[model samples]
Target chain A: MRFRTRRGIEVVAVADLSLDVADREFISIVGPSGCGKSTLLRVVAGLVRPTTGDVRLDGRRVEGPGADRGMVFQSYTLFPWLTVQGNVEFGLRIKGMAATERTRLAQDYIEMIGLRDFANHYPKELSGGMMQRVAIARALANDPEVLLMDEPFGALDAQTRIIMQELLVNLWQRTPKTIVFVTHDIDEALFLSDRVYIMTARPGQIKQVLNVALPRPRSLEVTTSPVFVDLKRTVLSSIREESLKAISLTGTE
Target chain B: MAESNTLRPIYRLGDDLRPHEPIPRSHYLIIAAASTLSLLALWAGLSYTGIVQPTYFLPTPGQVLATASRMLLDGTLAVNAWASIFVIVTGWAVATVMAVPLGILMGSFKFFEALFEPVVNFVRYLPVSAMIPLLILYIGLGVEEKVAVIFIGTFFQLILLVADVAAHVPKDLLDSAYTLGASRRRVVTRVLIPATLPGVMDNLRITIGWAWTYLIVAELVAADKGLGIMILESQRGLRTDRIFVGLVTIGLLGFCSDYIFKMVHRVALPWSPRIR
Candidate 1:
């Protein structure tokens, strides 16, 4: 696939790559800020208009925002007026699902996110981590085939970020959805991704795709393992080299 | 271990209590009573010394109370008060209905905002009282005229308020809603409207008070019945006591209505910051 900006700047100019994501593979795209990771995710979600590329889901051209792709944003953007249960059920309500079904499904997802006790509490009442959990649950409640998370844990504190990362890994393991996570954090990418695509600085292109052959059911302990360390080193060096090149280019300009 | 256990006394009976906590209710009551007593004593002292004549200018508090009791017994005071409140509430309702939708539309769409904002600004700058003669000319000196006066006073105020609230709906929230598959209608209803509700309620409070002021101005014309009319009639007849009674009624009614609206706001928007 290839794409260019409306201003005629080529963004992802040459990309003949195929990722054979199993029904629910976890893939992470890691690069510096403004490297089009978010743009690629939006293109995959069919939210952005790619100038020269087409996204195919089961070989069908992706049309528009649909149930197949659910997005969890960086900020916990739960509706402030709605209670935890209400926010989770928003998608279902829009689908014109019956009241009983909506309630049942919302309750089930609320429990899944460990927010059953806060079902009646408004979004403002929850902490940042709790609110993000609600956002994640809201996206997943629709049972989408692909879950696109755009720096979902980017705003949380370090301790909270690690906890949320563990929770997301567990959720992905249980549900088995094709997950495309975008982040600028190398360690997070290596920790969470089955495959990591290293991207160049904007206008971005794929620099390298590193397969993280680390064992499944990965834990924080794996972060210290030799394999994880080697992968992290590889990703870090790739990003550093791209950033230095970008800096030199800016210096010349 | 002992030092840590006794690090600091968490409770101190004499010094830890906040100034407002220990005797808030009693302190307020005492201050109010003292102020009232001093005012009454001053009035009595002036009257006794003949420094000011009560018959022409200031009426004694007793005289004002007696006049209020008489009107109450005759059912006239109650009727006039109810009439004034009814007119103000109706005008407020009409003004709110007209302003909110227009405000939301103007706030949401940039083109509509540009087209109508200048007209709104022009109308808002015009003194509401200046419209009295025109309203009277068009509607006659009837309930319609008074309601129109009240509506004109409140409508523009509410329009600016609601528009501001609608315009300030957070961009991040709207974007999230779109990504969640919410349509344009859903974004307006779910994301924008609810986010702007606190601002709308705040404007409603201000407009409600303005409505009362307009009611008084409206009655200054030819109305035979309302608190303002009663005040005007008493002034013409040199009945200071009756005038005092009407003025007090207006103050008390306005205060009570504002209090009621505050309670309603608290109930409706539970997520909003609590009033201190």
Candidate 2:
């Protein structure tokens, strides 16, 4: 994918980046800053059309954004006017679901996210953790086959990010949707995804694909395990080298 | 605030001047009342003491009050006030009905923006008051003529402001809607409208004040009735007290309308932080 800077100079954001994910699998893309990991995710979500290549989801060429692919951004994108319940029910309402049915469905997700008590509260009234949880519920309520998340927990404090990572895993286990998670955090990618796709510095490409050998029903305690540490070491070292390369390349430019 | 005392009291001088420090409701009310009373006192002192001189030019507060009561009891004040109110509201409402959808289109679609923005940009800056002679030639001295003057003053300005409010709808909100399987039209209806309505209400609120200004201008030349006409006639007769009555009546009407608009905004959009 290419973008024109405000000065009207054209630049490649992501180049020749190809990816595939199995249904019900959780995959993550981790890369250095400005490596187009976020751009790649947007291309897949069909928010931006790639300049050279195309994105395919289940044998269908992705042309524009659709309900089959759900997106959660790093920013808090909740409609400020909407209550937690209203936001969760947004897609369903667009699909023309009846009031009773959509409300019931929204209530189920609201309960699952543990925001049942604050379902009527506006996004402004919620904490960072609570709002992201509502965001996750809002995307999941539509029941999209695939969820595309771009650094979803990047804005949170360290403690909150860890908690959200764990909460997401639990949510995924119950619902079982294909999730393509993007983050700069090596540990987050390794802990949450079945496979981690590491990318090179901009113009971004898949540098290495690592399969996570961690067991199911994993807990935060498992992060201290020897196998988890070994995987974390490899992901960390690879990301560190790319980050250095990214900085030096920009310095030369 | 004075650390030398080693004891900080609950309230101190300039306490509320610090950024976002809370002030008690009663304290706020007292400050508000004090400022208003002081202004009135200043006005009364100037006129009653004849310091501003020529009692007709700067009439005493009591004289103005007497004139106001006389006009009120005779019912001409009600008739004139009603005429001005009706023309402004009717013209403003007509502008809103036509401009809102057009403004939405202009903001959302580049084609519409390109088509409409240049003309609107050119026309809005052309002074409305300068067009009065031309308007009088075309429409004569009828209520429709008065309404047309207000419409011309307001419609172009209202369209542009509403367009700005619509244009500022967040991209994340639109993207999220599209990803949720919303069609383009549905995004406009569901995402754009709800997100922009609070700002649009604000635009309507602000433009109504401008419309009130235009009503006075239109009434001054083009009408046989209204607060503006009363003010004009009183000036010729040199009844400064009656002119003051006209001024106060229009001020009261404008304040009431603005207050009502604010109250409606608060009630309709309880989620907004501007009021609640």
Q: Quick one: best DockQ, which candidate? A: 2
Model 2, A1-253: lDDT tens digits are: 7898899988888988788899999999999889998888888888898777898888989898999999998888898899999999999988889999999999999998889999999888899889899989999999998999998898999999999999999999999999999998888998999999999998888999999989998889888999889998888899889989998988954
Top candidate, metric TM-score:
2
lDDT of each: 0.83, 0.88
User: Model 1 off-target regions past 4 Å?
Assistant: A1-23, A34-54, A198-201, A204-208, A233-253, B1-67, B231-247, B266-276
Lowest lDDT 10-residue stretch of candidate 1 chain B: B11-20
Off by over 4 Å in 2: A98-100, B1-11, B19-22, B273-275
| Model 2 interface CAPRI class | medium
lDDT of 1 by residue, A1-253 (tens): 4565689865563344344556688889988666678878877777776666677877778877766788888876888788999988888888788999999999988887788999999877889999999999888887888889999999999999899889989888877889999998888888998889988876678889898998889999999999989988888889988888777766754
Q: What TM-score does structure 2 among the candidates reach?
A: 0.93
> lDDT, candidate 1, residue A192?
92
* Candidate 2: tens digits of C-alpha lDDT, residues B1-276: 557667757677587677888888888998899999999999899998888756667988899899899999999999999999888988888988898888888887889999999999999999988888888899787898788778888899889888887898878889988989999888888788888788888888887788888866888675778988888888899998888998888888889888998999989988875755
Cα-lDDT of candidate 2: 0.88
DockQ score of each predicted structure, in the order shown? 0.43, 0.78
